[model samples]
Target chain A: MTDRAPGPVRRIFTGPQRLAPHLAALSESSEYGRAIHNADPPPCDAPPWPEPHGGTPGTGLPRPDPQRSAGQALAVVRSGALTTVQDLGRYGHAHLGVPRSGALDPPALRLVNRLVGNPEGAAALETTLDGCAVRPRRAVTAAVAGAPCPVLVDGRPAPWGAPVRVPAGALLEVGRVVSGVRSYVAFGGGVAVEPVLGSRSTDLLSGLGPAPLREGTVLPLGPATGRAAPVDGVPTQAPPAELVLRIRLGPRDDWFTSAALRTLATRVYRVSAASNRIGLRTEGPPLERAVSAELPSEGMVTGAVQVPPDGRPLVFLADHPTTGGYPVVAVVAERDLPAAAQAAPGTPVRFVAVRHRSSG
Target chain B: MRALPVGDRALLVELADGEETAAFHAELLRRRAAGVLPPVREIVPAARTVLLDGLDDAASFAAGLDGWRAEAPDARVPDTVELPVRYDGPDLAEVAALWGVPAEEVARIHSAAEFRVAFCGFAPGFGYLTGLPARYAVPRRPTPRTAVPPGSVALAGPYTGVYPRSSPGGWQLIGTTDTVLWDPARVPAALLAPGTRVRFVATAAGR
Candidate 1:
């Protein structure tokens, strides 16, 4: 309720004479002053809101509008793919079947947050594949990181991976990604969505935090910090043509035969299109299970390489289920999980087994 | 006991039984309070295994687990939580018939046994408890209900549990409880955490 935006005046064109000034004001507010001014003058007379229709409590009639304060940040114009608010994650609740859902590529979130002068754990919009466009209610600085995408402000090209000052009411459009699966957008402050269970990240598996972005969803921005880290250029890795995930054999590795383990390490798998925040499903030869007997469900962690009865491996991600029944043959190192997020469908994948507890 | 590698930052410790699992879980909790396992973030206990996540040096921790001792009986027993239940459920008659006992006898048998929280899964605050004798094991509904209401006391193979939130379940419902199993406002939220002991008391009223 605190973040709700004040209602905008419903402008009705009486004649062509009044429309000229409105159109001119829009053009002038751009990076260059064409004809528009900073303030768009309000109409001389505005109609008061109608009284609420009272029939019955359950009656399908319109109720009086709650007080809506103007939002300080971005207004979603076009939410692309599957955008959701994300922070570090919700932790310490795995025993209760809660997954720690956060940004799949944490590095991208940190990079954009640094560019926008926000804290590392602040919530941001994670856009999948095709990017999103937003219009800020107040002037704010923003940066796009993660997957490479075109950054544009009111149809003018803006620098990617660097902070760009967006004037209030200007459309900041992030075009579809050139490569990779997800892109992150960080505001000057951060996404000020309400946190659920100590995290703002949306859990698709458990349905927590803010829901996935839809058109016209207004997101509040936190107050911007003055201290932004200076940077010449932040280094970014390209989307992997072939995702090579380094993993360590697991506690249930003995359940698989030697041939299966060999196949896991040697064979090339393709990233499945069904992959989402839950897990990175694969399409390849199934890893044959030596033990056909059912094992009781066990706790699953991020990056767990669990093999189902079908034999194809599924690398658990940020939104993976807390407990699973499948046997986990290996677990990808935490460091290599970011690359998994960026991997697109049909991208070749290889599992490289490393020494237990070894760093990549 | 065996400590097996899960990944670079986690290790799965397999124990002999649910009692040992509970003891090991309590030991981890005790050590975590003393700041011994500084890097360990989450310690999740299942039926016969405990997963340690976010460990700084998993290999070293696994090595140290070999010498680790299970805590005393006093330390192993977590706080016991009591739930008041009404001995009325849709499946109560079916369960009584299956056990070859009257409906009143079914309630007596369930409340007579002492229960311990073995592990938590399926939903938040939903703990699978161990205490029911093997003879009382009941088959799940051939077709699971589309929605089992929260607080529905249910029994399945080797475990008795309450549905923390409405979800599809195949477990046989024996009764219903009004006790709040999960509250987000409370510290640790889940009332039925792993290792907590539980006792169900039958109430006179159904509603």
Candidate 2:
């Protein structure tokens, strides 16, 4: 999906008003992270909005495929819960301020996508805490990823992270629980919806994309080859029941007292219930900054551990704003993004620092 | 003069040079030419200093910034951009109300002079427009609405900008123009780039 288009990729989006630049300046001054380009003409897996290919900004949750439009789309009906469209994220176009709001878990989402031959960054259903049951109006291929739940397709146990075939009117049910905050169900070919802002990922706060799925909402499906073959590059390493994420120090790291920076490297923290896609708030020893100035705003990036006036180091995540004013003491490596993406609330998180001596 | 940590990947650069901002900018430019600090993501220059981003970590990057402060650069400026605007906005009257002057007079003052686009941020395609006329300096709204429609011309606290899309914003709405400030399809979706000269020409329909 490299060099795809002016799609949704996580990058720094400059808002027209003073708030953006103000945040950018603060991000720089505080050593939070650089202003990544949300407007990455082509997409990468990084957040901000990482939807591959440009998306059409749909006003509401996309309607199900045309077959369901006759009366009501009935491929996958969530009996008691809400189902919303998700993708890896709307990649690129952050310069225009689009967010890479997509699947909370990238490896799982990509695993589901490859199992069904859908675009790796295609939009799927990111079902939260509870499970959803579907009544397929027609036959299609799909797979569930993350929060590994008990999914029954055609009344038989459906294997996870692998594609399964369903017949028309076949009831597909998911009821398994495992690690992670969200789960994704990608279909063969892919979820066919009007691409919005170069993504199908719904931005709850932005109001720029579609709404969540409700009862009777029919999802449109693009034609598929009917193959459930698992594609390569999908990480098969099971998500650790517990996780520890490694990180690097910040650019302007001197804001913190030397002892505080040392504490960060040696600390072992756990994700608080308050953590979400926006940021990871940890319950650990608070590090005191050297100076307490109401700093100006500056650029912010994913995995930036920004400590606000309260002194708690808030690790910015996928949906974090393009910029902020808090001083960041560290950043997670690009290679470890998947680990950060799969971090659920209450998950154990430790920051291991790696020093880069490169002058370039 | 002073150096600080901006983020994990950048350094807040201040230079000992009287032209501190330019000196840091020159050093960055030289390094870019020399391909030494490849991780420097964004380098924004101000009157006295520049902010650098894209450092691998905060500690080592800060060390480099400190060295630059001591070794100042001989001076040069980067290219600046120029932007065009139509002065007619819905809040023009409200803004003039604060000044106790006629709305048309405010327009005259706004278009009569030029302003610099200090930075690009807040939303994609949105520019942080600083350098407002002294009389027009106003604070932000006490309570911000949950949603402000896109293209709504707004001003707050000595700054003026347009909402690119519907979003949670605090700026007071002035007037709106049909300019597509951000279109991902365009080469440079952002209508206003940094360091651009701007002039607002009154338009009948935009009003």
Candidate 3:
């Protein structure tokens, strides 16, 4: 699992300029009939996509015994960056100090699952900045959504955001994210890792669920049910150029100075490079607090906009700690958090205070 | 008392004190169990606030907070769980010296107190108990240990807490407990959820 691809990866093109002939043979095995070799050759200076052990596409790679396609399981070949299994979240355990970890981009997860005929809450693989590659042990219907990326099965280009049936022993590589920080991948049958606290979500803060997918990790998929939704394509929101988070002022806004409150709404902040599942740290003007006293640790929820002594506001995410000592100036709306999750480092962030809308 | 808006779907109801917060939390928990408050996702109780998340309208819910009475039946009827403690800790002598008492006397005072679970945080099943008198309150260690072993009974600033799992903490350690404070395999998982009454029964140090 530790073996990593050396050097930079090659760019995979669509609508084919050139692909090695072996890709067509691999796609013929599946009834899906999706385009096979959509890759254009690398530019003269660019490095070619690495081929493992000089193995030719589809045939030369060692075929482990084919497990039945009834369940869609995949063997990890290249776990690019940080890839983890995620569902909706683990709820009803905040009092016990468990974090509610889930897909940071819920809409993306839901759409991918919908395309693959799985329930919205079904567990799926979430890949970070650089995408991951896996070889299905069995033929499976899957879709890549969220961040736009090059999708390939057995060196053959597959449609992104549409259902693609990947045959057994084919390498399904999700290329580097083009716009967003994370991507969602869903199979017909959900990733069937053992659920902890009734969820398959990997809680990075609490070290829950199966550890982040490493190169040799084999993921078990649930029994396939139903057929992929018949759709040519699904539209998705593009990663925002400026991440604007709408927030409602506060459970503890009084703790901050009037100038600090105004600064929060008016000032533009940039997303910090140190941002992770726990929080979206900002590298902007530090907010000044009116009170310097330490606040007793209290319960914190997802989307809590907590301000530390340093004054930089940290917008909590799915895997945020259940409790925090710092006062929260505001909380971002649940719907806007998905975009917050996709925000890249250095992306401009502006907090806009809006009147609380009653949806109930 | 005031109901502060936490977010669009949650409210942080500020109460007069920790007792009032616990009472309100108990009342809300009762309402949730009875299906009266259906939209409630999580009910988190801190020292002076009870955060209720996943609601339909937080403003309306907060406005209606007054009508929801804290009844006698829901008045902190805590589940008492006795924990056997070995009164041998790194900070036992220091804590005893701070209180101007012998180490055995410090253990005696800790064991005699009928502590109420104030709130659960820091780690799972780690409850901050409020039973010690104000005079007995001790400050946290100037430096925190890199890793405090699980089930370590510790004291810091008017509260006594047991470290549910091994984690870095600044609290002054005074004893150790064999009680399984947290076990995911068991139902409830946390032995000391909020409002669970706790009593430290001192055991022989080497036992």
Best by lDDT: 3
Report the lDDT of model 1 for residue B164: 72
Candidate 2 lDDT tens digits, B1-207: 555554346555655532344345556667788888756545655333455655667566665554554364343443444333455655566778887888778766665655555444555566656667667776666656656766676777656676776556666676666666775546565676555445555455644
* Model 2, runs deviating above 4 Å: A1-76, A79-84, A90-92, A196-198, A205-209, A230-242, A357-360, B1-105, B133-137, B147-149, B178-180, B183-190, B193-197, B202-207
lDDT of 2 by residue, A288-347 (tens): 899776444455666678886556676766666554556678777655656665565566
TM-score of chain B of 1: 0.94
lDDT per model vs. reference = 0.75, 0.58, 0.76
Best by DockQ: 3
DockQ order, best first, reads: 3, 1, 2
TM-scores for every candidate against the unseen true structure: 0.83, 0.69, 0.85
- Model 3 C-alpha lDDT per residue in residues A25-101, reported as the tens digit of each score: 22221111111111111111111122234322211111222364334568988776677788887787887777788
Candidate 3, pairs of clashing residues: none
Model 1 ranges off by over 4 Å: A1-69, A227-236, A356-360, B75-78
Q: Per TM-score, what order, best first?
A: 3, 1, 2
Tens-place lDDT per residue, model 1, A29-56, is: 1111111111121111111112124511
